[model samples]
Target chain A: MSTPVTSNPAQEESTVDHSKIKVSPEEMEAYDQSGRKPVLLGFFIAVVWLLIGTVLGDLSSFKFDRPDLLTEQAYLTFGRIRPAHLNVMVYGWASTAMFSVSLWLMPRLCRTPLRWGNLAVIGILVWTVGLGVGIALLLAGHGDGLEWLELDRQWADPLLVIGAAMVGASVWKTLAARNVHHLYVSIWYVAASYPWFLIIFLAGNMPFYKGVESAAVNWFYAHNALGLWLTTINLGLIYYLLPKIIGRPIYSYWLSLVGFWGLALFYALNGMHHLIGGPLPSWMIATSITASIMMIVPVVAVGINQHMTVVGRFGAMRYSPALTLAVIAAMSYTAVSLQGILTALVSVNRITHFTHWTIAHSHLGLYMFVTLSLFGGMYYILPRVLKKEWPSRRLVRAHILLVGGGMVLYIVALGIGGVLQGLSLLAPGEGFEASVSSAKPWLLLRSVSAVIISAGHLVFAYHAYLLAFTSRNSLTRHPPFYELKPVLVKKRVP
Target chain B: MTRILVLIMGAMATVIFALVILVILPNSMLSDLKAPPQLKQPGQQELLGRQLYISNGCIYCHTQQVRDPVFTTDIHKGLGNRPSVPADYVYDAPHLLGTMRTGPDLFNVGTRLPDRNWHLLHLYQPRALVPWSIMPGFPFLFEHKPTAEAGDKVLDIPKPYAPSEGVVIISKEAEALVAYLISLQHNYPAPDSDALEEVQP
Candidate 1:
């Protein structure tokens, strides 16, 4: 390796020339290969948790329509199952997948080998144990009973914090020792997310905030966990993967800055939409509504940047699984955010506040936007880290179609059903029970869609298993479309 | 950007935003809040029932707070008599102001449906009573007795939902849950809330 360039500390400026970083292709490739074991371990764990989460999510949804199906088993009761499903999905699947991507991305971005790969493995193990304990207690009837904060913080939370801290510290250390002078926008997102996670996780689980204040803090924690923790990292992954896959810089660097800062400024206040008609002060709700609407700024900024960059690269999406998923995720991010702003408006909130529309909206953000983007990141990262071709092109195609189909069915059924249920609730003569009954068909359909999605998850898990373990000699293509280049060209809007 | 700028932005958004909006502002505004005359601390039975309610994630389906009619239709729908204020929830230690109304608002469920027997039977098998309630039955909170004991109160569950060979007696947990459900009355108006209502057009 070239002698380690130790420049004077005072020469470091806010903007460093990207060309001066001097990270040779070999160095970059070495960094990518270094994270192989830990990242794959994370993916394996995440897929397994996703399968479990899908089953539980389906069982929980089914109970809403058919309450008598598993009444005998307390563990399978809808109440326990619902929270368990949420925890598993959010903490187990989504978070684990995010960690895997972050670990791989940090090393590449920093132009350094991951400093503590073994620590991340240990952290993942600890987190799995914490999740297991939390889920078991929830099923055994011992949860703390706050939305998103259901896991008993006293016992289970510290383990999570410790696990997260171990992983987070490793990233920080890698960043600190970086030979690169300038940090990318993606680095800004990844670096900022860890602190936000730690702060919110601690504050949300604390016993100090009580009663009405607790409700406020609860939303603060819940919404920010999605926004700051999940949204931040996934957006970072999108920013990284899109440019790398398409072999081009983002359309507008300044717009990316606006998008990142806008998200950092606005997302904390948006959680109060969950409390529009709540017992809090009206001004608080209005402020939150205003912030929620302001989210369009960042959403549009990111949308323009990503879309403009991919303007002429539509054909590249066919070969790159990562680009295809990222494009879908970027589009969903825009759609879901605009939808969020509309739902937060007083007129719409009056009709849809308590209905299934909120559920549909959340899934649009979580499943379509966050989870799908992570899937794309996984597709890109796995082959690079493993140094082998993906075993089956058909499996990846099948996984995408399955998830896309299931998600559409799930969101459409719930969206239409939520509107019908809301209007029925608003209509004076219709009894409340009638609204519940009217929603049964839609809820049943949601359960069916969940099964379809679960099938996609199994296929993904099986494919990942094959890619991780199968020998290199058995693969058809050596590098799996490594010579791919930009195939889409931008056209003038006029 | 400098590392300090990153730190500042994250802090301003996550910590400072929550401090100003969620904690400082709301707490300062509602500092004068006191429970209305009718609202009281939950009794021991009601507390146990509330625990059961929480443990079972009842808050996921049922919301407790009703909104202002000027903004929404909660009043006209008879979900609550007036807009709930912070004072309405002062006695509550852990406020259950749920987000979803998959079931109707339970702020004044006690006043709307107060019959004790109705609650017990309804909890045992919601479909048997309402014929279309999506709520899960709390059979785990009740027990099946071969015959009614000397002091046992047999639930009048409908023919289909009734245990095939035994009398369904309300267990202690069900009794506590019903007691908690019955104690959810918020019909009486607080002075501050009524004044706000009078000011509205």
Candidate 2:
């Protein structure tokens, strides 16, 4: 072990002895080896989906401005392509990426070699095939038609369930054999998400419910998929990555406790807020609205915890690319959650429910918060797993700036435009065309932002390919688990 | 050991709690709802049209629900006769209560614009009727014919939208989709239990 070199008293005060947290190289190697094939396979497939999803997203956004561009083919039509973009991003890119991250995170947190790693590999393969077939069926005009549940229920959804079960089994087995007696907060989140997702997925695809009841179940499943599945897992990643990068423990364990239970309790009820003033019982909508507001408890708890953890270490973000993206994503979690609460209020939902503002809000939550978290996890995980430095630091910087900047522009432009469009619709004297006109210029801006974001995705994808395939084993020694260390600023003797 | 059990069980209990409250309860509560006397189950053609609408992903752009007039201008804006109630949609399977209104609400569209020909032209080329509209034309849903056949419904597309050599004829899919759109009339009186009291402006 290396000696602790302390050059400044101030720095010494803040820096903990990381030696206590460091694992034996052999143990880490065992963990990494167990996860290697599954993680890489999952990541490679995820990148392909990311690129495909980006192209589809760009086409869909462009269609909003110029709907005539791809009218020659039925498959390329805006309606089909729009859902294709959504599914590919949510299930294809985000889901695969999250699964890969979990494969790595679970082993590390459990202090055990991953059990049944082959199951995960098979799971990923099955998932990829299912998603591909599902997207094809959608384009071929055979969708189930529920938003966020458009995949063919009979053929496609069954495969996804089977694939997910295999993956979940592997993770669960690893957790069961964990060396540690106590489970971490991250494990709790990851463990919970599996069952939560299974319940919702099955419920969403069930064929029995008809009419408004189906709509009720649809939103119920859709919102929980976000809250329980995506949000839950990504929040777990944030909890693990934020402190690990900063070389600090989380600011408050109790806050994590509050955040977790608060989310599980509140988020499930928040779905019906989407149908406010629609064809549901007013009491149900009111319950959702109340639950939506109650979400502030979790959001604030998480926000404060993450903020306080990184309070003095803001300078660390300059050196670690992962830190920068993860911190931004952490902040976005708070921003998007707060915005969601406000949007759920009757006064705001009245205007925003059916407009482009809701689109902007979804993007904020999905792209800015969840997708960025996955990217940050990838940046940290790939180097350790592949045992090499990133091929090009410049490419990573380019991706961060392009995607981050584009998201800001996207949310602002579409958010304002959606408000204007909603107001126009509400005005008694204004024609329906006025709402379309009001949204036109902003839709054009959204296309521009999509182009920027797509360029970023391409840069990251190429970098990932180079890292996985072409990069030399330049890292002779194992890279440090955490990238950031306290910089001891020495006092100059007068 | 107990802690792990608590964590897993606690997590699961929350979801079950939500499912019971949000899904199962509402489902049972609304299960007994009967379609109003004025509401009719769509005919076979209209059902086929509904399938086409679903397959084509029309619900992504157009909504079928009309919000309460107190909260929205849905009624004043001529989207529906009354706010949509659970009874208004008893026959719909895989309901089309879409989230976005990129296009106008279609719940009462059959009542709003009853012309079959107009819907056909709009589906073939939306911009033909509404020039500034961003809706995609389902040209693939139509067939180009050198000459019209007997009993064929040929689309009279405007000058800019029309092909120079052939006339546009509606396919079974497009016709069904139009039938579905025309069958979306839910102007029936709301059930007393679900009706909102009129508020003085």
lDDT of candidate model 2 versus the reference? 0.86
**Correct interface contacts retained, every candidate:** 0.60, 0.80
Clashing pairs in 2: B49-B176
Error of 1 at A291 (Å): 1.0
Q: Candidate 2, which CAPRI tier?
A: medium
What overall lDDT, based on C-alpha atoms, would model 1 receive against the true structure?
A: 0.81
Candidate 2, DockQ score (0 to 1) = 0.59
Clashing pairs in 1: A312-A488, A312-A489, A313-A488
The sequence of per-residue lDDT tens digits that candidate 1 reaches over residues A230-342 is 88899999988887787777777678878988887888778888898777766677778989999989989999988987889767786687888899998888898899999
Worst 10 residues of 2 chain A by lDDT: A485-494
Comparing only chain B with the true structure, the TM-scores of all models are: 0.87, 0.91
TM-scores vs. true structure, each candidate: 0.93, 0.94
lDDT at residue A241 of model 2 (Cα atoms): 87
Model 2 agreement with the true structure over A1-494: per-residue lDDT tens digits: 32223344443222232223467777777798789999999988989999999999999999888888889789999889999999999999999998898899999887789988999999989988888889999999888889999999987999999888888888888998886655677898887888789889998899999988899899999999899999988998988888888888778767878899999999998999889898887888888999999999999999998999889987777666778778989999999999999999989988888899999999999999999999998988898898887766668778888999899999999999999998988888999899999999999999899999998999999888878887564553433323433222233222
Q: Grade the docking of candidate 1.
A: medium
The window of 10 residues in a row where model 2 chain B has the poorest summed lDDT is B192-201
